[model samples]
Target chain A: MTRTEATRTGLDLAPDARVGIIAGGGSLPVEIARALARQGKSPFVVMTAGEVDRISDFDDYEQVTLRLEDVGSLLPTLKKHHVTHLVTAGHITRRPRLSAMRLNLGLLAWVPSLLVGVTQGDDTVLKLFVRRIERSGIKVVGAHEIVPELVAAEGVLTKAAPRKSDWRDIDAAHAAAKAIGALDIGQAAVAVGGRAIALEGVEGTDGLLERTRQLRGHGRLAGRTRGVLVKCAKPGQELRADLPSIGPQTVEAAHAAGLAGIAVEAGRSLILEGPTVVARANALGLFVVGLPAAEPAHGK
Target chain B: MTRTEATRTGLDLAPDARVGIIAGGGSLPVEIARALARQGKSPFVVMTAGEVDRISDFDDYEQVTLRLEDVGSLLPTLKKHHVTHLVTAGHITRRPRLSAMRLNLGLLAWVPSLLVGVTQGDDTVLKLFVRRIERSGIKVVGAHEIVPELVAAEGVLTKAAPRKSDWRDIDAAHAAAKAIGALDIGQAAVAVGGRAIALEGVEGTDGLLERTRQLRGHGRLAGRTRGVLVKCAKPGQELRADLPSIGPQTVEAAHAAGLAGIAVEAGRSLILEGPTVVARANALGLFVVGLPAAEPAHGK
Candidate 1:
């Protein structure tokens, strides 16, 4: 549905539409809760312990938090709240090591499939969770559905436009980032003067930016000015759980890295506090562009 | 032809036959010279800068070394040497920056295509150079042609076998390494307890090994007694140049990293100084396996 149509409808969220949210570690869950509140719906936030913070806030929102391993409790919690819709957000910084996670009977039954999916490098666990929620009669909506403006658009978003050389570096960094993403290795790569300086590994984007700065300090960067940082969703990735997102902090990181520009996939990416991020980037003289990744290069 | 057959047949080395050797930074060139000597042929070695050392020995063997960027002079040099067969081996550490290279006219002409090819991460620049050589009437041969024994075979080579847990980590590291290789980002990845700890970048494998050791010393890898290091050729990689090779030093590195095992793609990977490498790995109680990567779960 179009944005205007959806907005006009005012979103038919039940006053007590027990929304189930599989919370990760980030402020996204809090933002999601606020959005749900606007729709007159209260969610049962199943927060993944060690990932989520501010547990007391969940009480204020009339929600509950749960450890990642408490899958058995999750189903009952959803049923208790009569949750008709489910949404998940936030950053699960640490993927529980398969060996370390203690699985209960319900989770044990799904272990074989989960292992197969993970071994295949597919987000099988998340998919299975979604399926379970649907089977329980809960609808799952795109995280952006409640806040469409958070979805980034195609075009230059920063006050400072990229210089010609910055554009060239952006182009190079984009190709490099996609190459890395295609391999499911990382979402971002930092490049300077047509050479890759740092690749994002299991470390998140911020860590990668910090490493880029360090590498630059060691005289490994291409130019004296900061290089370009490019981030994109992996080709054929399961976007619901881990879509690439940037915020004001990302702009600050870019400034610290002395980046010439920051380019992210348009539409597929998220821009938390968009105006603030752009303003910060502009103030730092860092160009930020949301380039269209719709037409991904063929045979990727 | 079998080695014995080729030896008995006394293969002809025409004065006009142009051979190209894409030399990596290692002692493999010396061995290549010995093999070529047996055939009464001396190949011209094209060494990448900052990779190979002691080029003076090549003069004694009637061999010539050229910079990677001197593409304009490469064809003429091959013509001068009457080089017909080309072989590439050793470690060509990925450069931190490409802009510093002084691309000659011939290379400049191919820059656009090369850029697209390189950025696509489908083929290494070394492989691209091989294609250019072939187009210029030079035949590229597998480095193993000179030392067939170096070509790794399927199955465990070391006496010691990996623990069950080590096998799991090895599998995980193998998958992760292939993913990294597919991106043309790196060839090696280290994983302990199913968590990727380090990825090889511009830093050579030895340096990476040392870093892993240091991290282990700092108690970062406390519970994980042994990590698995997986190295593989990039997907659709050109076998003629820069085929991944593990030698005695690799085993030493694994021991230093406190790694339980090292896995490489069978047949596709090279085992330089095979006897010594296997003996050392066995001595260090490290398992070395050459498993076929034909059906690797991920693609380049």
Candidate 2:
């Protein structure tokens, strides 16, 4: 169907129509926006509070501010701009206070979901967000869909490839990371010497790394310095929002935290500043590899 | 089978036969030894080196010290005492250097499982240990099998019961803890405000609690302190070894960590110093509940 036809009827349509980007924290939203704009499509961005959304850089798109609690106005805003497709990038770790939300018609419609979402894990809430947007006649697209280059490719992405020993750590971390995702706990897990040293929690990757670093050798035995940081999509995850991403910052943090390398899920993970990240990791003598989807069967 | 009959041959038998205790760290081994002695059985104790196992108080047991690397002596020692049944109690977080081992015929016999065990998580190694002992004509029993009082009881354990809101945190922590267990990563998980704040890693439950305390409010949004500490058995865990245990130390830590309560898998978990644990929990106004085996179906 034509874009105008889909917009006028306020019904579902292919992603070829107008894309609305709901930007959260991090540089992902800006990248998604630029990618969409480069494709000659207009994107109306709803910037959440505490996000790195400086929308003035975009000359072809419109921008609006929306607190997480004020999610009610999101639907009307999308409808007002004739948005038929939507994209959510970055993350929202802090939950919004229910009482503080504006409680508009759209938000009111999702009260049940939001109520359940409050006590649920990050994936469940993100899934709810996607369902809410899709229910409003907007199709949610992963930012990677708009820019394939952002998605990590299979195999090594740095000069220093993972050694044979590191593969064990990678597989271990990958399995633990998947288990974390399956439980909707988090996306990342740290493994040292084939043992999971830490799993990402609400405190995030940085905190997980920091705790691992501090507690590594603090146990009865010394913790190994070399480990792999595996970030992968949860077994059941909403791909549109919060697909695990790695940037130069992650590389620096992993290095600082004494990890030997970073391993991300191939084709499903995002690697921002890919070349810079690779070069930086190579400089730090750290490896960055994208693991294939079909993980080797764990022998244990 | 009669106790004497079972000890005569290299065959598996119930723990009612002659029992041997492999004591690691902490006071649990002492408790188990005492329980077995009270049951009119002469228990042989192999205290792992670096453990706090001073068995002078025991009048009815033979004791020997063995370094972790000297695992080869374990089987021979068990057979010398006519130990047809065994129990492993307490904790051991540090792994031994395989190269430093004084490999004996028994340790060499189980070298394959030990090699596999070295790279696997705690549960796998514990499972291997159980298999090694059982294969050597000795049956391993959980410490709880000797001391029924060690197992936690159902429902609120202290005067202070979990308030309605704490249930959400309990469920969240329980799910995360189980996931940690399913992956054979760790035994405990802490949640606050419906978010998994920390997961037990190699650092153990105490370390997990400490990290949660330090990183609770350190997240993007202030993490709620009114969550729970849930310690459950890992999926497919060999109940004979490393069943999650909490005690007065746990109560003190939970109180200091500012948690609302502590929840544990009722039938599968151990409560060391139960009266003191309950008393401390009550004094701190923190709830300690033995959660039922069946978890409420997670809404997510």
TM-score of each: 0.73, 0.82
Per-residue lDDT value at A294 in model 1? 61
* Residue-level lDDT tens digits of model 1 in A50-131: 7777566567565665655455567677777777777778776554445655767766755665566443433445666666
Candidate 2 collision pairs: none
* Candidate 1 lDDT tens digits, B1-300: 012233321234566564456666666776676667666565667765666775665665554555545555767776777777777776654433456557667667667645664344435566566667778777767776666656677888778777777777777777666765765656787777665666665444665576577667432243457878888887777776667778788889889888888888876777776767877887789988887777432222
Total clashing residue pairs per candidate? 11, 0
lDDT of 2 at B45: 85
- Tell me the interface RMSD of model 1, in angstroms: 5.9
Looking at every candidate separately, what fraction of the true A–B Cα contacts under 8 Å does it contain? 0.05, 0.62
Which number leads on TM-score?
A: 2
What does the lDDT read for residue B100 in candidate 2?
Answer: 76
C-alpha root-mean-square deviation, candidate 2: 7.4
